[model samples]
Target: MLEVLNNDWKRLLEEKMYLCVSIALTICSIVAAIVLTNTMQTKGNIAMVVTDQSANTSLSKKFSSSPYFHVSKMKKAPLESDMVQNRYDAIVTMKEDGSYNIKTIKSDDMKKMIVGALNNPDSYVPSNDKDREIGTNIMGYMMMFVLIQGLFYARFFAKDKEEHIIKRVVTSPIAFRKYLFGHATFILGMIFAPTFAVILIAKILGVAIGFSLLTYALLIAVLSILATAFALFLNSFFCVADTANMIGTATITLTTILAGSFYSFTKKESVLDKLVHLLPQKDFINYVNALEKGHLSRNIELQFIYVLVISAIFFLIAVMKTKRDYVYR
Candidate 1:
């Protein structure tokens, strides 16, 4: 496996274009995610229509001064459409007693911050993740790029089959399983380095790239492993790189979109929703969103487990198919 790994690295010298483009696209997408997120006004935009005029002026003047929130007094309750458009993050309505009612398109998590802000003028720290998830958007854009990069890297495995390189390994001291494992390791390592680099650079730049560096690495590593497994599975079924790639691109684009990689995925009582749930990307993205709100139990790690199981399933199918086709035959 080590020799196989080394040999593949040397082969990559002749295939640098794919590798370089993968890195370039990954970086470009990260930048785009950041730009799009920042361009949208978010987080601090609040419309306060307190029923008590005295409390209204006082609280608005108070919390608005805090950096974490901006309080704009409204003549009436702000429209839900304004909230949908992100013009207002939330609407605060205070009673004569000074107690308040809050409404927003976002979750209750932001409400806690609002209440705390009203209670203490000095309370402005981010209670959890920032209202806009810079990190989530970056990873969201990344899903499509990394998945395709996996198919490109796995082309090496298909190249071996087409060139009869595996026949030599079959009769050599190396078992077929090791050869397959070697290919997977090489693909995983190659994909991880560039992906991890994006997170490292973001952290260094002090960008709100969402999660901690360790967390990003864990997520990327798991995603990379899944990509490698998917690539291997596709290549096993179709040894010709072109054929595998054509099928992979179409399949990945459609599924990733359906998984709602870019936008929100709506669920309904239909077979389509069930199909979307079966997609690993859907669960992966949902888990990320869940983590941001602190509703996620870190101990459970159920979503990660599900993704890993899918990866294993892909790898097993690839191994079983190849063993039957090339080794047993």
Candidate 2:
């Protein structure tokens, strides 16, 4: 294992593309989070357009002064066009009789905020959805990066197999078990390095991550192990790099979706919701969120255990398959 790690470290130092990509991705993630947080901080702007020339009144004044809206006046004729283009969250048109009509493309929540703000201006507080938005985006992309890294590992394994490198290594003085361990460790290191770097970069950019750096580092380590093991397991079924990549990518994509990387699937009680608890990404992300709040729950340990167990099972199966098929006396 040490031998493989040493060799991998040297190889990594010599190859700079992975490092470049990792840094680029980290910068992009931080930039995206900043833009998204700002958008959330501002909330949605409600546009007011008065059709009647004499309809300027206290209602428009109230909307302009409200904390929830950034009011803009436009001719009422362009309301539908502006809304379709997402130019405004909502539009208010005043009638000459002091009555008004409201049209909005805003979500129900934003609509409620507008109504609430108008009813009692002093009681209205601006909504801050930055935390939730940032959380979802970070969790989703982190899992995506991990899963794609697994696919890359699978390709690497397949390449070694195709080139008869694994056979040669097994026939060498180095023990097969040590080589396998070293190989897995190397892959995990690759995944963890990029993942941790991205988080640190985001933190440096003033993006609020829920967990402390140390906690996130630990979580990333666990995720890396799971990703590497799963990749090895998938590679066990194929001798060709292309075949393994196809299978690994498809498998990872399906499992990722099931794991709720894109959205929460555990909101309602259902078979899928209950069953997805077995997925590592879902559990890991949830655990990270909890830790961000500075509380460690039983679920955190459960997720850690599940990932370790699944990784062990997959790696053992992969090793056994390799011993049976590739390694020879």
| Alpha-carbon lDDT, every model | 0.81, 0.70
Model 2 quality (TM-score):
0.67
Best candidate according to lDDT? 1
Model 2, span 36-145: residue lDDT tens: 65564445666766765534666666767765567776665464777756677677666655566766654456666777666566677755431344554565556766
**TM-score for each prediction?**
0.72, 0.67
In model 1, the runs with Cα more than 4 Å from the true position are 42-132, 268-271, 297-300
Count: clashes, candidate 1: 0
The Cα error of candidate 2 at residue 276, in Å, is 2.3
Q: Candidate 1, residues 190-261: lDDT per residue as tens digits? A: 899998997798889987788888888888988899899999999999868899999998999999988878
Model 2, stretches more than 4 Å misplaced? 6-19, 41-137, 204-207
Which residue window of length 10 is worst by lDDT in model 1?
A: 123-132
